[model samples]
Target: MTGGPSRGARGGRAWREGHAAEWIAALWLMLKGYRILGFRLKSRAGEIDILARRGRVLAVVEVKRRKTMQAALAALTPHQTARLVAAAQQVVRGRKALQALEIRLDLVALAPGRFPRHRRGVGA
Candidate 1:
């Protein structure tokens, strides 16, 4: 059997798709009353896809572009989870007002042309 797309070709497509997904998700969040605080926030620990807020609620969201929920969930490796938690803590520590606000971890899994599957209040 012949190899399909080369590694570079596949990677380029995936990168483009991921950016598209992020833009779509960001727009969706804006429409849903969430104020976008940061996009692609990174620390030594890890990167947070999106950080948005609704009132006093601080949300750490992971945006996944996947064909299925299983595929999306699979992307959240244990190491990533740890880093997400650490980054969230760092965010909270920096702002006293935000620190008192209830923190929520969420997942937004996007499948092409479909409603994003949002899982809210995820814990470590």
Candidate 2:
């Protein structure tokens, strides 16, 4: 008997899609002059979707994908924001290169066929 895609397969597809959004977001940031420092940075605190730098500013970016930009912008919960902030701290501590830069929380919302909306200093 042929079976349909398993739960894990569906989850894996979602994961790949998420990562693809992140890659697109990263490119978008680069086009805006921010140097991509890291992607999917994980620590005991949490995971940071993207980390970038421009001059003395260190941006901790969260990438979200949804059917609409509004939904993507609303995706980050307060608890998750706290976790991202904490994780950014850990990320900076480990990387001496990021030590001197001023840290800021940023958001990148992605939807199909639209430019990524980058909001800086979001929930910082």
Candidate 3:
């Protein structure tokens, strides 16, 4: 067998990387004045990586970490995007206070040795 980590080990490392990426994204959002409302929230639609709010903007954030920024950005597929939006809507539906806020699908793309790139209003 060639020299490489086992499948389980690779999977575990990916999970750890994802978890750390989420934390980094959260901190980046908080520093930008967004209040984190939820982290890894599991709703009827899907699992939302992060839910944040700043003024009237409610951001449904998806955190992605890969070797490159392009890879990170490409990680969020259309189906996943729809799920994220649905999850955000569910959160809004459950809270009357969030009814008036604008729901924005945001992306926090992370790569090694680089600052997180937070893109807002990515629904379109």
Candidate 2 vs 3: which has more TM-score: 2
Please write out the lDDT profile of model 3 over residues 1-124, one tens digit for every residue.
Answer: 8689999999999899889999999999999999999899988999889999999999999999999998998888899889889998898899999999999999999999999999987776
Candidate 1 lDDT, tens digit per residue, 14-120?
Answer: 99998888878888888889988888887766778899899888889888888876687567666666788899888778777678877788877887657877777
Specify the poorest-scoring 10-residue window by lDDT in model 2: 1-10
Which residue pairs of candidate 2 clash? none
Better of 1 and 2 by TM-score: 2
TM-score for each prediction?
A: 0.83, 0.93, 0.92
Predictions in order: lDDT? 0.81, 0.92, 0.92
Better-scoring candidate (TM-score), 1 or 3: 3
Residue pairs in collision within model 3? none
TM-score of model 3 vs. true structure: 0.92
Scanning candidate 1 in windows of ten residues, the lowest lDDT window is 73-82
> Per-residue lDDT for 17 in model 1?
91
Q: Write the per-residue lDDT of candidate 2 for residues 41-86, one digit (tens) a residue.
A: 8999998988899999999999999999899999988998899889
